[model samples]
Target: MQDQFDLDVFGNYLFIFCGGSRNKYNALHWDGDGFILLYKRLKSGVIQVIQWPRSREDLRMVSQQELRWLLEGLSIEQPKAIKKAKTGYFH
Candidate 1:
């Protein structure tokens, strides 16, 4: 899968990543030739790899749309149910 999407930066090919809150099987759209859309449908497990303690955490399943943010060095920020304690509490 990586072999196909990973393209050179000489304009010869382009690789686009799109992540979203949808299922893993969501087909991503790429405006290119022979650019295959890769997706995986988990039968009985989680689609994204995360920790067990976070397993119960409300995770927004990423799709092709969200994958864009990931490739750009950004991260998916799902609205967490349990908010973390405020920083500078002692201040």
Candidate 2:
């Protein structure tokens, strides 16, 4: 049970699982002090999972930095876009 999620109030987390099939995945969630579950599947194709480190296996504990990287598709090897200030949130 490898997970990439944040425990911070402003951060989100994701859970990775390998149960269903090649086209689907399950994400058990953590809502603040509680737990929840989320599921995802490709509508017209299969989902691809990247190779993760073969060490961390606890879902309840994941780093915020790692979760940020996963959710934003940002990594050391990839060229990430310049982060600009968020605007136009409301009208």
Candidate 3:
């Protein structure tokens, strides 16, 4: 994962979904000392399809609510929800 993603820093959570069926997921995190891997599998019901970004240019940060939606088998894009404020917009 570090090599594929070109990760040079620690303290970031990387979420990985299995292809086909999509019933399992792996969460990889760097805990400053070593890597920790967490895996989860649904007993029933497959995880909803997510429109994942295909390229580096499409990558963006997601909020806690968005992560929750994803785990609950929902899209992260909440069209009706208030959007997060951009950095340095007030200044």
Please provide, for model 1 over 42-66, each residue's C-alpha lDDT reduced to its tens digit, 9 standing for 90 to 100: 4443334232122224333455545
Q: After aligning candidate 1 to the native by TM-score, how far in Å is the CA of 82 from where it should be? A: 12
Q: Model 3 segments beyond 4 Å from truth?
A: 9-11, 79-91
Model 2 per-residue lDDT tens digits across residues 1-91: 3243323422355555644454556665677777676655555554433554355442334456544444443442335645446787765
Cα shift from native, residue 31, model 3 (Å): 0.8
Q: After superposition on all CA atoms, how large is the RMSD of candidate 3?
A: 3.3
Every candidate's lDDT: 0.41, 0.49, 0.67
Using TM-score as the yardstick, the better of models 1 and 3 is 3
- How high a TM-score does candidate 2 get? 0.40
By TM-score rank, best first, the candidates go 3, 2, 1
Candidate 2, run of 10 with poorest lDDT: 1-10
